[model samples]
Target: MDPLSEVLSLLKLRSYVSGGFDAAGDWAIRFGPHEGIKFHAVVAGSCWLSVEGELPVQVNAGECFLLSRGLPFSIASDLSLDPIHVSQVLPPNPSGRILSYNGGGDYLSIGGHFTLAEGQADLLLQVLPPLLHVRDQLGSATLRWCVERMRQELAEGQPGDFIVAQQLATIVLVQALRFYLSGRKAENPGWLFALADKRLCAAMAAMHATPGERWTLQTLARVAGMSRTAFAVTFKGTVGLSPIAYLTHWRMMQAADHLVSSRCSLAEIGSAVGYDSEKSFGAAFKRVMRCSPREYGRRQGGKGGPMLRSGPTSSSTHTGG
Candidate 1:
């Protein structure tokens, strides 16, 4: 599988559709820093997303964006408008119903949050930008389909709503990643850029496809069809890490996921990711995840359990796509 596919599969993200929102005239909503990733899709009308440290981006109908790293931001009709906290305007509604906020103009959108694997969000975040903007997804059938599915799931609240929504959310992120990578130049630096390089892509695919392989620089270089010296230089330059370092990161990410989602023994988990022993795996995991394997499981809400979903489950007001 491709690196992006591998990363998405390992994340085991749970998505919750937080209904929809409608606003008219002068209005802005501040979404506070959330624990999980948040996203917004403009179904009708337009808005400006003002994320700190980046210029406000104008999003029209059919456009969507993903905000990770829990950076607080505001969506407004205009950048000059004073914003109201989403909590203040939307308020809590015990009754799950469509929400509307009247200002003057008509705007419609749907939003939700994605809860990633416990103690392993940073591994995925490190490869993606803080903001992933998909301008005019109307032209992309895949994106449109995913959004429509999510909207339907949120609106109908059928028996399989949660499962369908979660699946759609994964598709949305995958499509968004494809959109971002396709738009970026080959020379760009980052994991995404690295995936674009044919030689590096070969090596990355190898690493992701078989994390337990006893991979060495020489073997990886052979996989990339490059000499050891050139592959090492290009891999580090393109991926921002040595080949071994990247492999370790990938292994630990897989280990973290298994630790939280499975009932396997620590030694089995370690061996699955190429570690020879449980002690070695624990050391590497601590170095990367900042916690011991047992501690990490506890922090993740205990072993062999579902990851906790963060953010608002049900809100008073929501607007549909």
Candidate 2:
């Protein structure tokens, strides 16, 4: 079974939203999740998205804030804003279609809400200021072109419009991730994918391929073709975690899944993950996931029925791109 199959980055989406203002002014949005990432893009209008405890971020039309690590933040017409709903205020002098959010049915099918009732445990919350907008920015040639095309497909409401809209939204989201990641300073990066370095994606590929191998910073630096110091700095800047820290986290996440899903014993699991002893394995697992191997196993077993791991269970599968 592919261990990486069930792993999805915290959050990712592309959306075409209506500019949240009536007047020729800007608006903003703030977002905070107890956990997970928040991402946003502006099709039209202008505003700033400020992370409360972090540095302030500014976004314009055709731009996005890929808050890779979820933080409590807000957006406003100017800085110092709170998340106000699109319906919060109407356009000051309405001559055009001034709606709080983008209009029409296709928006829902495209930007999501397509499977809200499908028991999707990973659904994003609706109450979010993580995404913001402005008035004049929406008039840009680039944004206008994208919005018009999306609107047309959604407006047509044809048989294949649903699929077409989702694909377009996904494209928009990818554009936002690129813009957000490109302009960040060293103080920030992803919270988990620390090995998600511009240069270190290759290093991660190495580790993922051989998680059972003994890894050292020096060796990793060689794989990255940099001095240890330069590799460390670049790796942390892009991934937001140290190399050793990232490896430990990835191992623990995988170990948790394996212990619960596979027939492997604690000793086997520990050895498979580069741990030489059960004690060392248990210690690492606790440090990362806050639970011991025995505790994790006990929790997975039913109170009274044939235990699942007593024999093999049906295998699960997923598709990857």
Q: What is the C-alpha RMSD of each candidate to the true structure, in Å?
A: 9.9, 9.2
Estimate candidate 2's RMSD in Å: 9.2
- For candidate 2, the lDDT comes to 0.50
TM-score of 2: 0.55
lDDT by residue for model 1 (74-172), tens: 999888889888888766562333467884338877788888775566766766677878987434677777777776776786887867777787777
Writing each residue's lDDT as its tens digit, candidate 2 over 1-321 gives 121222322122233332222223444433335343344445455556666566656655554454433456666666644466433444666322323443321111112211111111132332123432222232244434554455566556567654565555555543433333333433424532332254586677666666667888888889878899998887777666788777776677566656655777676777777787777778998887677877776765442212224322222221110
RMSD of 1: 9.9
Residue pairs clashing in model 1 are: 20-318, 20-319, 21-318, 21-319, 24-104, 24-105, 25-104, 25-105, 99-317, 99-318
Error of 1 at 259 (Å): 3.0
Candidate 2, which ten residues in sequence have the lowest lDDT sum? 112-121
Best by TM-score: 1
- Candidate 1 accuracy as lDDT: 0.77
